[model samples]
Target: MARTTGSHSDITGPRVRAAALSLFAQHGFAAVSMRQIAREVGVQAGALYNYTPDKQSLLFDLMQTHMSDLLSSRDKLPETASPLEALETFTRFHIRFHSERPEEVFIAYMELRNLEPENFEAIEKLRRTYEDQLENILRAGVSEGVFKVADPKLATMAVIAMLTGVNTWFREGGRLSLEEVEQIYWDMVRKSVGA
Candidate 1:
């Protein structure tokens, strides 16, 4: 057994997840094998077992980690910030974060069918928690007469879908910088919310 130690083990997990996510996104989850993931991670097939019990567990871990990081980041927004400011913060964060981790975002959105029912439910719940934060901000804005949304929930989904779509087209060598992309998204989001 190749015993991974120290920071290497910690680094290996994310690297493996990233590789798995990219492969799974390119070739449907059902088409991927543990050996493939292990190879991509530059480890022996059996070595992957040291990081995750099985393929399903690996998928679950990826989604769970992404969602957890998302929620934690959103939760850190300043409490005194206005709903519009919060929305702006969310918009910028969503674009920048997703842009940097497109593979993870692609996996999270595309590999839902591969997870078992229990794992799927857990991931879905975490996703909703993040969505709810945006909805709550929209609702608060509407209540304060700062936003004019007909349905905060639907608007929340629309905004997120639009923002997340950025990862699909954004490239490191793209003409617009990440800051510019964020500003464009922030403008669209503000307009959509009537902020």
Candidate 2:
């Protein structure tokens, strides 16, 4: 099908993806219909096909976009000197990045089961790339005797889980500010690796 004309064309694609992301985050992928997404986007059910081939494609696109953004943003941070500095940077960055994107983070983790095998593989590849960033830091720390991580791979997984878990309970106006939370978590991560 030909694309929609005029300014509407530019915005419709993003709008559709945003609507689908919100819906899929609230209701599982299996539970949300294309029509529901179209309704949310203020477009006809058939019109969604102009932007996405089908629901599965839309789901894959959302996940792919989220992971891509995560990688791109991470790559832009300034390089740190020591492995300890890099690990602290990674810890603070993960908490801040994942916290701001609660919805995307939720769908990224919860909706993985809904992706087809190939799509799942692709998303997992991107995820591993992100994880490897931290794992490498741990390995360097261990090599330099700055950290005592027996298995960098296992330490990577644990640190990521601990940082990501902040999203589940953190709020803007609660007891601690996000900066404070970042510091507290960084301290815990530092201790965990024996840095």
Candidate 3:
């Protein structure tokens, strides 16, 4: 099919993904269809093929982009002098980052079962890399005799699960501000690792 008049891939491509993300987050991957995404994007159903080969590919791309942005943002955080400081930074960062993108977080966690085997592996690798950052911090603290974690790996997962759990209950103007929530979580995390 010929390209739609006045349509640009640069602009429409992101709209397509955004629409898919929103729909997937709202209705789930198995329930959502490319035609629905195209309608949400204000394009014809067939137009979506210009951007993604299939719904599975679109889902994979959304997940991949989320993980990539997460890693990139995390890598930019300034280095800290001690494992204690690093752990604090990571605890706050994870809460802040995941909370801000609730839809992406929801889809990333909820839609994993829908991913194809290879895509699932790829996303899992990225998640492990992020988790490894926290694990390494726990390891460093253990080596320095600051953190009393019995198992750095277990502590990493626990801390991350605790931090990410904030998103499920957090709202912008609720009982606690995000900063306050961050501080509360930081304190819990510090004690969890015996820092």
Per-model tally of clashing residue pairs: 0, 0, 0
Q: Per-residue lDDT tens digits of candidate 3, residues 55-122? A: 99999999999999999997344565689888888988899999999999999999999999999999
Residue 49 local lDDT, model 3: 92
Ranking of all candidate structures by their TM-score, best first: 2, 3, 1
Per-model TM against the reference: 0.89, 0.95, 0.94
User: Candidate 2 — which residues are off by over 4 angstroms?
Assistant: 1-6, 75-80
RMSD of 2: 2.4
| TM-score-superior candidate, 1 or 3 | 3
Clashes of 2: 0
Clashing pairs in 1: none
- In model 2, pairs of residues that clash are none
Candidate 2 at residue 1, lDDT? Answer: 56
Candidates 1 and 2 compared by lDDT, better number: 2
Give the alpha-carbon lDDT of every model.
0.88, 0.92, 0.92
lDDT of 2 by residue, 164-194 (tens): 9999999999999999999999999999999
